[model samples]
Structure formats: structure tokens, C-alpha cells
Target: MLNERISAAKQIASELHAAQEAIDEVMIRIARLAGTLPAARRDTNMSAIVGQDAMAKVAQALAASGDVRQLLTDAHLALTATQKQVGLGTRMFGAGVKPPSAMFADEGSNDRGVVTALAQAS
Candidate 1:
């Protein structure tokens, strides 16, 4: 049962990551479309003026995508915390984390990786 639950958690995490990536890709595509559209430098006609104003909608879409990004990030963070609570430790899934070579690492290894590696070694 425990093994099944862990497996399920792993699958959920994977799916969550995939969903986040898909949303990001969509935002990128929209942004590229926005760039591809010809700029309306002069509002000489209704079409040009509308084109200029349409960018506001594009900007709103980008802003909405940003909100979605935050939601995905929050979900990821919550899953990480859940992993820690379930005795999964601080190791990143499918990634190796090593402590800094420095004797003391508060300042040295903040970027090195998770400190759990050091704790487990000693």
C-alpha cells in the first residue's frame, strides 16, 4: 500500500510538471504571435488603430499566463513539501544533489545543492 501510494505520488508529480510545461509553451507561442504581428506605428485607419489597441488584449493574455505560472509553481512547491513530510527526504526526484566541498557551507554551498547529502554522509 505504501509503495502504491509513493508510486502514485511520483506519477502525480510527473503529470503536474508536464501540465506546467504545456502552459509555459502556450504562453511562449502566444508571445511569438504577438511579436510576429506587424506593428501599427501610425493609426491612420480603423484597422491600424484596432491593431494597435489589440495589443492590450495580448498583454492581458500574457498577464493571465503569468498567473497560471504562479499557480503551477505553488502546486510544485506544495508537492515538494508533501514529499518532505512523507519521509522522502530533501533529495530532488531523478536528480543528484551533492553538498559543497567546503568545510562550512552556509555561505559556500547555498548554490551547491541540498544539504541533505551532507547530513546523510555524516
Candidate 2:
């Protein structure tokens, strides 16, 4: 049983790692696209088309990777379980943790509800 559990854990980790790798690749591509966005928006350059093309490619890549969906589902389940255990905020968007825009919004606050509301709006 222990071995089976270990094996399952390892598989989950591997799948999640591959998904993260895909996400990292997508992020890098998106970053490059973002860098080009400003210049593209300013001028009718070929880079604008290229940026859109790159974004489409990234989206395609993500869509093609089934492990990405599985990994996200796994993460959602884990987070949900964690939230239940902690008896805290909703797990819809990673509640009970530091938000990325928290620094811009406020200091010394765990207002996940607010964060969640803003995120949903976006």
C-alpha cells in the first residue's frame, strides 16, 4: 500500500511537473508577446502580427497538452482539501494565500474575499 501510494504520488508529481513546464513555456511566450505588444500597439509593425501568432501558438500548445488540464484539476482538488482542513476562505482562486496584487492593493491584509471579487471581475 505504501509503495502504491508512493508510486501514485510520484506519478502525480511528474504529471504536475510536465504541466508546469508547459505553463512555463507558455509564460515565456506570453512574456515575449507582451514585450512586443507595446511596440505593436504603437506602430503597424509585423511584430504585432507575430505577437498575436505567438499567443495563438501558446494557446494551441496549452490546449494540446492534456496533462495541463489534469494538473490543474489536481491542484484545484488539493487546494480545496487544504481550504477545508484550514476552515478558511473559498478555494475558487487560491484563497488563504498571499495574492499577487496584494502589494498594490493593501498591506498586512488577508482579504481573499476582496481579491477573489476583483479576480472574478477581471
Candidate 3:
């Protein structure tokens, strides 16, 4: 029974990690696209084609994605607690409890500066 549970714990941790990663990736991409919308609208030929509200819409998505990422991060913390409860210990998953932004900042491996850029863009 203990072995089965340990295996399950590993699987859950992997899934949670993947979920965090997917959200981060999408948020970064959306924010990048949001950053470009204004430039796209500035082209005289493109201005006629780009909706005035396009930038606002993309920014909204980026912000909402951040919220989603936060929720997932919180879930990760909760899962860590459960891991401890089940005697899997703190080292069962990640090395430490760093938030996604700081852990993956500036390396372009995660959604670190993307949120701030989104806020400033607003």
C-alpha cells in the first residue's frame, strides 16, 4: 500500500508541474502577442484591419492567465502539504518552495517578467 501511494504521489507531482508549465507558457505567448498588437495597429495598412479593441482584449487574456497561474501555484503548495501528510517528505517534489516567477525569472524558461510587462502595458 505504501509503495502504491508513493507512486501515485510521484505521478501527481509530475502532473502538477506540467500544469504549471503549460499555464506559464500560454501566458507568456499571449502577453507577447498582446505586446505586438499595438505595433500591428500602427501600420497604416494594418490599422484598417486590426480592431481598436484588439490590444485590450489580448491584455485581458494575459491578466486572466496570470490569475490561472496563481491558482495553480496555490494548488502546488497545497499538494506539497499533502505530500508531507502522507510521509513523502519535503524532498519528494521540488527542491524548495520558490514561486514560479522567481524560480524561472529572466531565464526565459518560465513566465517571470511576462506578468509585469502585462501590467505595464495596461
Query: Which 10 consecutive residues of model 1 have the lowest summed lDDT?
Result: 96-105
CA deviation > 4 Å runs, candidate 3: 45-50, 94-122
How do the residues 17-81 of candidate 1 rate in per-residue lDDT, one tens digit apiece? 68887998989988976775544333243465556667778878888998999998777777766
Better of 1 and 2 by TM-score: 1
**Weakest lDDT window of 10 consecutive positions for candidate 3:** 101-110
Task: Return the TM-score for each candidate structure.
Answer: 0.65, 0.37, 0.69
lDDT (Cα, 0-100) at 14 in candidate 1:
75
Model 2 Cα lDDT, one tens digit per residue, 1-122: 64664455556546655766677677676656656666665587454455676667656665555556566756845744554454433323322344445312223346656666877897
Best by TM-score: 3
Q: State, as a TM-score between 0 and 1, how close model 2 is to the true structure.
A: 0.37
Return whichever of 2 and 3 wins on lDDT.
3
TM for candidate 1 is 0.65
In Å, residue 83's CA in model 2 sits off its true spot by 15
Clashing pairs in 3: none
* Residue pairs that clash (backbone atoms under 3 angstroms), model 2: none
Question: Which candidate would rank higher by lDDT, 1 or 3?
Answer: 3
